[model samples]
Target chain A: MLDAFLGWTGVVFVFIGVFFLFLGALGILRLPDLLNRLQAGTKSTTLGVVATSIGVGLIVRGWILFAAALAVFLLMTNPISSHAIARASYRAGVKLYPGTHPDKCEERKWKLPEDGEEK
Target chain B: MRNDTPILVKKITALSLITILMVGFFWAFTEMPKGSSVNVNNRVSRLYILKNVKAATKSLNSGNFFAKGMKPLRSDVPYSPITFGKSANLEDGAANVVTSIVVDYRGFDTLGEVTVLFLAATGVAMLFFGKRKKNIIKAQASLIMSVGTRIAYAVILLFGIYIFVHGHLTPGGGFPGGAVIASGVLGLFLGNDHYESNHLGLKLFESLSGMAFVIIGLTGLFSVNSFLANFLPTGVIGDLYSAGFIALIYIAIGMKVGAELSAVVDSMIVDTEEEWS
Candidate 1:
């Protein structure tokens, strides 16, 4: 009885993870501007993957440790990688969405070059 | 415009070429034995799979062919089941069949592959040999990016070492392990603008590891009468110390590949004066 309940729970988790992954993909496609897309893509996908791996681990009890390790690794790396990309693009003069206000990068003494100057 | 052959002539040539190719393909296909008619027991790969090469060869060449009703074949030999942790004293003791084949059965091919990679790295390095200027990155990496890279590099390095060390028992091996380490080096490059790998150290390490591979092969030749033979005792399958020289060869390959690839990345990322022209 316990095994069956756990199995069903795992299946539901898997479905939820897949749904989130689909939403992330949709956001990547539909979101305007690079920074917003990066935010949507990274956050949703990280959550999606962690959920999916946990679900898989619950289903295959023997591989729980490996799945957990993978999840931890992903969690540590994903945000840093996204940060790197965003910093690089900003330096290269990718324009912010005009609606964005209170530009914080300028406060950090980051000189924004003209669009083609960085190249 | 240049004058072209007539359309009819072109059509005739193309048709003839197609006909010739089709005929050749059909001829080869017909010559090959198809489906269940072919006996796979006759293939050398069957011996490798069954781990019965020595025994099968002996049974076939035992010199009792005329007296027997039928000739002894490789398929006639009985093979015991290979358990993950229990099987021992095997001809090749690696738990992973792919590892056994690549390192034991066909090690020379792997050597050739490593050599090819070495040559390619050498060519790339030579092209960018002179004093290198830092490649321009418009902005500095953020504090989080730099700090996170340092933490991640340690973990990545540990994982790479684990992969190569456990090559005989697991799915991963030297090439992948080395690539993983090189990627960590690449992350280092991204995180720090001034960070440079020790060039002399990398070159020395790569050369020494490559030499170690050759020396091991030579040891096999001297002691066992064949190149890259499994000269050391293969312990129990799935054990850390198992698979005889496979682990040693993998370590050598992993180190060599890691150093060579790191050097290649270094050369590619740093700009040379020639690029300015």
Candidate 2:
């Protein structure tokens, strides 16, 4: 009974994870500009991978250790990778979306050289 | 002649090459036995699995050849049953059969592979030889990236070590382990703009490890009658101390490969100043 319950729960988690991953891909396609797309892509994918791996760990009795370790590694690395991309893009002078407001990077004086004068 | 080749000629050449490749592939495919009907009882793998290669070799040497289409009976050559953790002093006692085959049965091939990798590394290093500048990234790496890379590098290095050390017992081996270590070095390069790996140290380590491999093989040739033979006593299977010289060979390969790859990464990342004379 417990095994059946765990299996069903795992299946539900896997379904949710897949759904989130699909949504993340869709967001990546539809989102405006680089930063916005990265936000949608990285955050949702991180959650999706974590949940999917955990679900898989639950399903496979012997794989829990490796699965959990993978989840932790992904959780730590994904955000940092996204942050690096965002920083690189900003420094490289990729323009933000026209409709977007609130220039926090400009306010903080994080802008590098003038536009077109790439270092 | 090379640059001004006609499009029609190029297309024809590509088509002919593909046709030849496909023909060879199909010919090999026809020779392969299909489906579950294929019998493995008479195959050499049976002796490997049972750890009875010595018996089979002895039988073959003593002029006990099997008749046409007839499998060798147990009465002809006895096969000893090998239980994990109980069997000792077997000819090749690696728990991972692939490791046993690669390191013990066809070690010369592995040496050739290592030499190929060395030549490739040497080529890369030679390409970026002489006065060089750092290939600077436009944007400085973020704080998180730098710190995270340091932590991740350590973890990756440890994991690579674990992989090569357990090559005799697990699916991973020297090549993959070295790749993992090189990836860590790549991360280091990305995270730090001024990060310079010690060139002399890497070269020395690489050469030393390569020499170690050749020396071990020479030792085997001197002690035993064959090159790269299992000279040491292979302990019980599944133990860390088992598999004769497989673990030692893997360690040497792992170090050599890691150093070579790291040097390659260093050469590629550091920009060479062009001398357009």
Candidate 2: tens digits of C-alpha lDDT, residues A7-116: 88888888889988998999999999999999989999999989999898888868989989999889888888888888888777799999878888888877654433
Q: Which candidate is the best by lDDT?
A: 2
**Given candidate 2, what's the lDDT at residue B255?**
96
lDDT, each prediction: 0.86, 0.87
Taking all chains together, each candidate's TM-score versus the true structure is 0.80, 0.81
Model 2 agreement with the true structure over B99-208: per-residue lDDT tens digits:
99898888999999999999999999877887776454555566788899988899899999999999999998999999999999999999975688999999999999
User: How much is B66 displaced in model 1, in angstroms?
Assistant: 16
Interface RMSD of each: 4.5, 4.8
Q: After superposition, how far is residue B226 of candidate 1 from its true place, in Å?
A: 1.8
* Clash-forming residue pairs, model 2: none
Lowest-sum lDDT 10-residue window in model 1 chain B: B64-73
List runs of model 1 lying over 4 Å from the truth: A1-9, A106-109, A112-119, B1-43, B58-76, B134-137, B273-277
Clashes of 1: 0
